[model samples]
Target chain A: MDRSKLHSVIALDMVEFEFNGTPHKSPPQTTVAGLLESLGIEYRFCAVEVNEEILPKAQYSIYEVKPGDRIEVVTLVGGG
Target chain B: MSTNIHRLSVAGKLLESRVIVGTGKYETLDVMRESLDASGTSCVTVAVRREKLYDRDGKNLLDYIDLKRYTLLPNTAGCFNAKDAVRVARMGREILSDLGNPGADWVKLEVLGDTKTLLPDPVATLEACQRLVEDGFKVLCYTSDCPIMAVRLKSAGAASVMPAASPIGSGQGILNPNNLKIILEYLKSDDPDYPVIIDAGVGTASDVAEVFELGADGVLLNTAIAHARDPIMMASAVRNSAIAGRQAYLAGRIPKRLYAMASSPEEGVITSRPW
Candidate 1:
C-alpha cells in the first residue's frame, strides 16, 4: 500500500464536532466521558448538552460522539 | 408579646431568611462570599454558563460558596425565549441534582423580552413556567409587576410569583406599589399563604423594607447589595430591613388620612393653631 493512501485512511476515521461553540475534531466512537476526560473537566461538577438535548450524567459514558454534533459543557456561575 | 417563628415557605420548602441575594456583579468573589454571609440569606441565586476551558486553575463559584450554608437556586437569567429557558432550567436541575443539593428540583424561571430594560417576557415566562411545573419542577416564575400576569402564573402552577419592583438592576425601588399590592391581594385572595416575592429593582435597604411592608412574602435582589459602595455594609442593612419590614407589616400600619386628628383632646389643647 502507498504511504499517502494509508495516511488518508486514518484521517477519515476522525469526526468533526463543535465543542462549546468552537470547532473540534475527535476520533470516531469517542464517548462524552472520554471527551470530558481529555478536556480535563470533572464531569460531576458540570452539565453537558449534545445537539441541544441535555445529556444526563448517567449517559455520558455510553453516548458516543458523532460527526457534526454540537456539544456544550456548562457549570454554575454568578448570576441573579 | 408571644414569640413566633416566621419562615418563608414555598412549594413545601421552608427557608429561614426571607431575603434572597444573587451571586453576581460583585467586585470580587471573596467580597461576594462575605456579602452573602452578611446578608443573612439562606438561599442564593446562580447562573449557568459554558465552562471556561484551558485554565489549569480548578477554582469555581462553588469553591467560594459554602454549599452547606446556602441553597443554590439556579436561574435562567439570560434566556429570552421559552425554549431556551426550559433547556437552561433542565441543565440547572441536572447539575444541582448531581451535586445532591436540595434546590435540584426547582428553578428560578426568567424569560426576558429584550436586552434594553431587561424586562420579562410575560408570554414566554408563563409558557416556561407551565412546562417546568409539568416536568416536576417547583417553578418560581419571575414576571413584570402586572397583577394579571401574576394571577395567570399562579394558575399555571408556579410555586411562587416573583414580581419585579422595577426593571432589573435599575435601582428604581418599587416603582408601582399599587400593582404589587394588587398582586398580593389576588394571589393571596383564597390561598392566603401563597408566597408572592418581589424579585428585582431594589435600590437600598428601604426598598427591601417596603417590599416586606407591602405584604410580600420575600424579596430577591442582587445589584442592590453587590454593586453597593460597601457591599458588606449594604448586606447588613438589607438583613435588618427585612426583619424590620416584616415586623412593621405584622404590626399593621395606621390608615393614611388627609386631615390630622389631634392625639390629645381638643379641649386639652392650650395653644391655638398658627393657621
Candidate 2:
C-alpha cells in the first residue's frame, strides 16, 4: 500500500465529505473539529456522529478521525 | 335540550378545537405566530433536535412560540429507534422544564423505519410509546394507516394514535381513507376512550375537513398551512373547515348512495317519462 496516497473517507450521513488534502496521511491524526476547520466549514447547527457513536459537542475537539469511518452530521432546519 | 358535543381531551386538557398546527415552514416567526393564533389551535406540535439548542447568543426557536397561547407537543421527528426516541423525549422534557414550561408533557412519538417515505416503524413506535407513557409522558404516537396497529398502539397506553393520511409531506390527501375510517371506527367502538388524531398527508382545507368528517378526534398538519401562498389565510380556512367537519359529524351525516332519490311526491306530481 502507498502510504502517501492513502486517505480516510469521512462519510456524512451516507454522503462522502472526503478529506484528502492532508500531507501527513498516517490516519490524519486530526480531531473532527479540526477536520471540519481544515475544510473551511463550521458547525453551524449540527450534531456529529462517528462510527454510529454520537459525538458530544464538547468532545468534538478530543475525538480523532479514522479511515473507513462513517460520520453523520445532522443539521436541524424546521419541521413538525 | 341537546347535549353538548364532546371534544378530545389529553392529560386533563380539553382540546375543543381538533386542528393541531405545527410551528414550522412559515417565512417568519411573526407569520407563524399569527397563523397559529388565527387557526385557533389549542395544541401545536414541534420537532426537537440537538442542534436547535445551539442558537446565536440567546435566540432560540422555543422563544418564538408562546407557551400560554397553545399547549406544546414536542415530537421525535428524526429518531429511527426506540432508544433514540427515549433520549429525544428526555431532552425535550429537560428543555421544557428549564423554560419554566412544565406542562409540556405531551410528546408526538415518531420512529421512522425508512427515510424515503418517512413511514413509522410500528414495532419501535409501540415500544417507545410504552416507555414514554410509563415515564409519565403523554404519548401521541405517529403510526401507519393500519387499524390493527392503531388498536395495538391504543392498547399499549398511547394518549392518542395519529395515523398518517399518506406518506409524510407527500400531500397525497388521504391515500387510505377506508383504513383511516376503519381505525376511527375500531377505536370508537372497541375502546371508545382513545383519541384518534389524523396526522400527515393533508394538502389543503378540504383534506382537513375529510379527516375530521371521518370521525377523527383531531388533525395534525404542517405543510398544508405553513407552505401555502397565504399561510395565515389558509390557516384560518383550515381551522374553519375542521370545525365545520366536527360539527357536521356531530350533527350526523346521511349515508352515501349510488342512486339519486326522488324528492317530489309520487302521488300528487305527474312527470313525463320516455318509456
Best by DockQ: 1
| Global lDDT scores for all candidate models | 0.92, 0.76
Tens digit per residue, CA lDDT, model 1, B70-115? 8889999999999999999999998888676778888999999999
TM-score of chain B of each: 0.94, 0.91
Across A20-70, the per-residue lDDT of candidate 1 in tens digits comes to 999998888999999999998888779999999989888999999999999
Q: Using TM-score, give the best candidate's number.
A: 1
TM-score of each: 0.93, 0.75
Alpha-carbon runs more than 4 Å astray in model 1: A1-10, B1-6, B54-57, B262-275
CA-based DockQ, model 1: 0.80
Q: Weakest 10 consecutive residues, lDDT, candidate 2 chain B?
A: B50-59
Please give the clash total of every predicted structure, in order. 0, 0
